[model samples]
Target: EADIYQTPRYLVIGTGKKITLECSQTMGHDKMYWYQQDPGMELHLIHYSYGVNSTEKGDLSSESTVSRIRTEHFPLTLESARPSHTSQYLCASTGLAQETQYFGPGTRLLVL
Candidate 1:
């Protein structure tokens, strides 16, 4: 079981709709990340934050944006949804004392 949580475990939206994926951790982790993936494909890191007020875009280019204003919450938002944006979003957080990361149940999105 993981302490991290993700809202709207599954999402279906039309093109041009705005959507936000919420992620939160109960473990008080300072490091959090968002990954984009397709079924049967490798995960791509899309965004990350070291702590509050610190965020960086990841290796993959993503139209979505993320914010880390509080220590336990990190949310990803897309201003306008598109069919090309369909993918699974995974949220993870790592404890300061451990290298292991706790992952939330991924949000599966489909934009039609």
Candidate 2:
């Protein structure tokens, strides 16, 4: 199996609620990232971390926040979600940016 995993492959949430997207990896990768993607399109960086306790915001705007505690786990949380927050969340990791990043199947979220 792939090293990465994301739960709730699909989620339909109501407006103004809290949600957390789980991401974990078996591989001992120190780098982890969270990206937002629209259907049939490219991915946009939303959040990233180089190592433990080193988290940085991406160039894009997201209502979500991420935390990295263990080397193999990173989870994103949305304090209050809206319809505008609906998008596919892809979790990825790599030893380096130039190297290939392994991605999770993604969590497709829709808010109405």
Candidate 3:
């Protein structure tokens, strides 16, 4: 099983605030993904990266930036948060040759 974790599992912030949702994995996986979802909604891929120093935008139109500085770390940052940005952010990682993704406990953000 992939050992992944997210910090600040629950957060409440005001709009226009800057926030970063951190995601880390113990497994040395090269592929990481970030997803966003609303209450009772499907997940939307926001960002993903295959390896260090590689970042890719997913299907969703997001205002978040992600960095892949290390194989086990992929953090998502929102420069200016909004009410619409309030949702659950999920982190997932998979091995280079593996298709099965192991997910971390999501961070739930509530922007006031």
Of the candidates numbered 2 and 3, which has the greater lDDT value?
Answer: 3
lDDT of each: 0.96, 0.91, 0.94
**TM-scores of all models?**
0.97, 0.94, 0.97
lDDT for model 2, on a 0 to 1 scale? Answer: 0.91
lDDT of 3: 0.94
Residue 29 C-alpha lDDT in model 1: 96
RMSD of 2: 1.5
Q: Residue-wise lDDT of candidate 3 within 4-105, one digit each (tens)?
A: 999989999999999989999988999999999898999999999999999999999999999989888999999999999989999999999998999998
Which pairs in model 1 have colliding backbones? none
All-Cα superposition RMSD per candidate: 0.7, 1.5, 0.8
User: lDDT (0-100) at residue 41 of candidate 2?
Assistant: 89
Q: Per-residue alpha-carbon lDDT of model 1 for 1-112, expressed as tens digits? A: 8889999999999999999999999999999999999999999999999999999999999999999999999999999999999999999999777798889999999999
